[model samples]
Target: MNNNNISIQDRSKLFAVRAIKAYTELNKRHFDDAGKVLAKQFLRASTSIGANLAEGEFAQSKADFISKYSIALKEASETRYWIDIMIRSEIISENKFSSMIDEINIIIRILISTIKKLKDK
Candidate 1:
């Protein structure tokens, strides 16, 4: 799918997939036990981003939609943090996490923009 035209739901789902792959790689003993813990946290936050976005799609009201999007933004932010920690700890290389980080940043921006638009309306 074209990145420019992709919906937030699709984009977040794609992000989740990437995060899962990262989790898989990290589980392969990329670091110490602490790395696994961080990986699990990272996976949870990353996947939640999409889950919340999907929930927003079926929102019962404008406030519900905004709420879901806000949750997604928070998840995206948490994902970004986990990935950065991984990078800093050398569990995941900077090169490896760059795209993943970039993707989360984009998702966060989109979620923030969407939520703001809904609130403004």
Candidate 2:
């Protein structure tokens, strides 16, 4: 498939966008010192999704693409981890945390399936 044919609204891209937005909003809120550490980790992991996706797009081969996407998948998982920590620590409310986690979970599944399909080809 041609890269230009891919829409920015694709699940992977959309999830990354949502993650970045959520992290930016979270960063604006004041937090205790301990909470701040989780916040920073959350921001980094969330933003890494898109950054890695961009790298995947420019991959020189199928293996390179899969490698970059695998990194994105890992980042999504990491984002989920930090989100869980934030919710359990009361840094973010259950409702907000759950929504973000749901999105990340969906993205993870999509990435996994895509990787599998590519590997099979």
Best by lDDT, which number?
1
Query: Model 2, poorest ten-residue lDDT window?
Result: 1-10
lDDT computed for candidate 1: 0.87
The digit string of per-residue lDDT tens for model 1 on 26-100 reads 787756779888999999999998898889889999999899899999999999999888888888899978777
Q: Which regions of candidate 2 deviate over 4 angstroms?
A: 1-10
- Position 43, candidate 2: lDDT: 81
lDDT of 2 by residue, 25-104 (tens): 87788878888889889888887887888888889999999999889889889998998888898898879767677777
RMSD of candidate 1 to true structure, Å: 1.4
Q: CA lDDT of each candidate?
A: 0.87, 0.79
Q: lDDT (0-100) at residue 24 of candidate 2?
A: 81
Candidate 2 global TM-score = 0.83
Show the colliding residue pairs in model 1.
none
TM-score of each: 0.94, 0.83
